[model samples]
Target chain A: MFQPEAGKTHLLNRMSIKIITYLSQAPASTDEICHTLAVKFQLTSDAAFLRNIDNTLHHFDALGLIKKVK
Target chain B: MTDKKEHKQAQIEQQLALKASEDSLSKNKRRRLLKGAVALPVIMTLHSGAALARTSNMIGDAPAVDAQVDMEGRLLCAHPDPTQPQIAGGPYDLGMMPSGHYEKQIDGNGPISLDNQAINCRAGGGVVISGVAYTSIMSRSGFNIM
Candidate 1:
């Protein structure tokens, strides 16, 4: 298992890469993604998780890795 | 058995690829059709459907915000969907925001009875005023004339 010794920004980038890979398969809403993440990572709090996913999506959108279906 | 599984996966992949292509085509067609449906001038003049109420370009004139001007041009006051989640203490609180509203041009190039005469639509034709994607040189953050 690869352990990340880097700080929050690096962790965020790695998480965003995972997000982009998942989204490459199909478009998903923030809620749907957070639920999946929470289940996979065993995290809690859907609403707060949504905010993090939303922010990451915003960055991905700016980078043109994904586009809003709507 | 492994070969059979690979073939099955290939078939599913083919189907997914076909579906994705169909979706992309449909979205493109819808966007093109929507472009044609709205009046070209309205499309050009106003870009911000909601944030357009703040027309800082007009010197003394209050921005004309009917927000919901009917393309059918009917005089109907469209009340935004009540169930739609709104920004609390914002436009929703005022009951002034529309679900969607076209931005109106702030001024014309004619000598009008307004305090600041610099901005007007009298001389320009088809020159886009509203819905500008570029940052205004005269805006306050850059420059606020109004």
Candidate 2:
């Protein structure tokens, strides 16, 4: 995916694709996204996995792909 | 009997091969998926100048907090747990020491001897500021204090 604001291109893997897809549908917190993705992908939803999702969300926020809700 | 032994050996070999293949495939697939998922910012920026400028200017201004007064009585409980009520004796103040100085005292306690290491809020020892007794929630030798 190409981010025009950052002038950078990203290779979206299956997990990232799922994250963006979920965010596109509705606004959700880190825990909400983690839980939803865990159930969808049959993942363990451990701390490390949750941290990965948080990092991805932060990256998207930096690129202006997603906005943090007040 | 010879034929029976040969049949059993073939069955065992086939099962081992099947298990090995399944393990290798699953391990490889999971490893690749997780690697790509966690390792982000994979590609190069098309416009380095713009990206660099944006990054450089991300933080417009940062107000200095060292000079600010910590009026919250946070000194009483450094890491307050919501479940536990605030330390008694309200209207706490930082006393004569400036906020920055007080913060430093709390942050760095040169070298806490083993005797001082046992002194903590739970142990009933506290610091007195402006004649108000406030239990320092953290331990002097604990990792929390830098």
Candidate 3:
């Protein structure tokens, strides 16, 4: 009775891969991850933009992809 | 009799091998699904943001110090030193010392030492000269030095 959606595939870009990979390596506070992204990838000027990435992490967590240790 | 036994054993081995392969395949699929679930949206956002910022120079321009301050503030707030009392109306002067007499002796003796020249052999009695330096600094600032 359970059916997975057919022909649906999730794709991630390189930068996202990089960010997630970094996060997976260690449990970092959201701000720390955002700083790393900004410094390493030159992502955005607004520090508040980090909140968007935090939201993304929450999404990943909901999917059982990542977890918040702290 | 040997042939029949061998055939039965082979069938058993084949069944085990098939089950093992199926299990491994299912595990791989589950792992891939998990990875996709976690990685996909993050990647999408990064890609989209990059694409949008490609036309402008403002991408990832956040000041480094601001980031450092944010990180430091987060760490400080999470596990602050218990000994450091919280104070109001200014930066918590962690370096400030309380208004009291602290004694340091050049010689290892009680309150008094008899011979001044013997001070070399025995620890000398050097009182805190005075808290003049500290008092001046505290009085001038008008801040609690505790």
Model 2 misplaced stretches (Cα beyond 4 Å): B1-146
Which regions of candidate 1 are displaced past 4 Å?
A: A1-12, B1-146
> Model 1 residue A49 lDDT?
82
Q: Return the top candidate by lDDT.
A: 2
Those runs of model 3 whose alpha carbons end farther than 4 Å from true positions after fitting are A1-9, B1-146
Taking the tens digit of each residue's C-alpha lDDT, what string does model 1 give over B19-109?
9999999999999999886533210111112332222222111222321122432221212235433333222211222222222323376
Residues B51-145 of candidate 3 have per-residue lDDT tens digits of 12111001111122221111112100111122443223211222233222221223366432223322321132111111233334345432231
Model 3 chain B weakest lDDT span, ten residues long? B53-62
Give the TM-score of each candidate. 0.27, 0.31, 0.27
How would you encode candidate 2's per-residue C-alpha lDDT over B1-146 as one tens digit per residue? Answer: 69999999999999999999999999999999999976643321122222222211010111122111235322221222233222244212222221112232233656433233223322442222221122121121121321
By TM-score, rank the candidates, best first: 2, 3, 1
**Model 3: per-residue Cα lDDT at residue B116:** 30
Using TM-score as the measure, which candidate wins?
2
Candidate 2 residues A1-70, lDDT tens each?
Answer: 4343454556678888777767666667777788889999999999999889879887777776676654
